[model samples]
Target: MTATTTPNSHTATGERADLLTALAKQRHFLRFTTRDLTDEQAGLRTTASALCLGGLVKHVTSVERIWADFIVDGPSAMPDFTAWTEADLARRADEFRMLPGETLAGVLAEYAEVARRTDDLVTALPDLGATQPLPKAPWFEADAEWSARRVLMHVVAETAQHAGHADIIRESLDGAKSMG
Candidate 1:
């Protein structure tokens, strides 16, 4: 939950260690950016975008959970979008906006659990080179395959990118910057 060492610590010897460490470092930065924010503060739309600290936490958790599922079951394991109801669509859209009754603490706790699950999978995966086709998505190349290692790197990138977004939002909130 806490990243005590640098991201390089993850790569001391093996690729798995490197990926996990990078993921952990990104998670740590994300958490650190939200430190001291109240539920209201975290939910505030400090920037023009719908992004908020709590929402960022929720989004990252969802991303990790889905990707972890893919790691275990391959692309066929992804959710069927055609079957999604209006409520489901709305919920997915709202994943980046902390709504009523949501608390930063609760969101952070959930994210932590998701992170734990991902870490466990990273350790348990028999082979990082095991490949799977990318799920249908606009951002993904059609029918492209991704190795397990690539998926881990993708998760790390997603977390780090969102960490930057959170840092910006937090700075706007109270001038509390995660980086100097």
Candidate 2:
């Protein structure tokens, strides 16, 4: 099919459109899991896992933003996980919980904004084949490089994985399932 114009006026065809569609579907599932949840419920730990609904959204948002930056700026865009201090670890832990004064609406809004920027980047990037070396981290192989396409796929995977987590958490919280 020829490149089709999206409602947002972005033209994406083939692989780009496929990536956007997959990411959007996963994002919808993730957000849907939080429907009608109050801040208290969104913050509640529904299972043994430390993840909460709002925190999952927050974590996914951070992951998407960081990976999108990596696609644009190479290894320099990521944090030095190998050199994280205790404070850094603590702050990272906080991303999995809803801290005081945080609301579910606020978390979802930030996630929506990040998703918009990522979708925009996918639509605007000239080449999906644009590659960047991976950052130094224990979880990543040294000298590995990822194309923009690969980064986007990773983002979709992460979002989908967390969406599943959110589904379970939501079910535990109130027996509401994203899908029956």
Candidate 3:
């Protein structure tokens, strides 16, 4: 669904606004890391880690989209991590790289679209207290349920963390810093 901005130019208020604002700030920092960089530069790994600026953007976009779906559709929205096939693992790994013909602009555009959808969901959800069962994954506790509020918080945290990673990668690439 297309995202709608409120008359006040804010999609939410109170806690939801706070969450969206935090997410937006992190998204800005993450995108800023790729400013003026060519596709090759964005895809280049500057540090020992495999992460690159464009790849981080793509990965975070996927993460935010998945968690937003989880908020709406429960654990069914997620993949069965325990039963992932080789192809599934390979596909997941591919999320962290800009493969041939994947431009940085394309990645950023997709990320923006996903962010808009997530913001719309946050604004339209009737209850921030709505809960859903967490997907079964090695990293998640078995049978735990998370409220929509918690899910949004997790998204914010993940974006912030990846923005930091992107910042490091950017600095190492060409000595560009997202912030002082």
TM-score of each: 0.88, 0.96, 0.94
Model 3 clash pairs are none
User: 2 or 3, which is superior by TM-score?
Assistant: 2
Q: What digit string (tens of lDDT, one per residue) describes model 3 on residues 98-178?
A: 999999999999998998888888888999999999888999998999999999999999999999999999999989899
Measured by TM-score, the strongest candidate is: 2
Q: Write the per-residue lDDT of candidate 2 for residues 85-141, one digit (tens) a residue.
A: 999999999998999999999999999899888888999999999999998899999
Give the best candidate by lDDT.
Answer: 2
Cα distance off (Å), candidate 3, residue 163: 0.5
The predicted structure with the larger lDDT, 1 or 3, is 3
RMSD of each candidate relative to the true structure: 3.9, 1.4, 3.4
Candidate 1 lDDT, 14-98, residue by residue in tens: 6766788789889999999989878999889999988889999999999999999898898877776547789988989899888
How does model 2 score by TM-score?
0.96
lDDT ranking, best first: 2, 3, 1
Error of 1 at 72 (Å): 0.3
Model 3 misses residue 133 by how many Å? 0.5
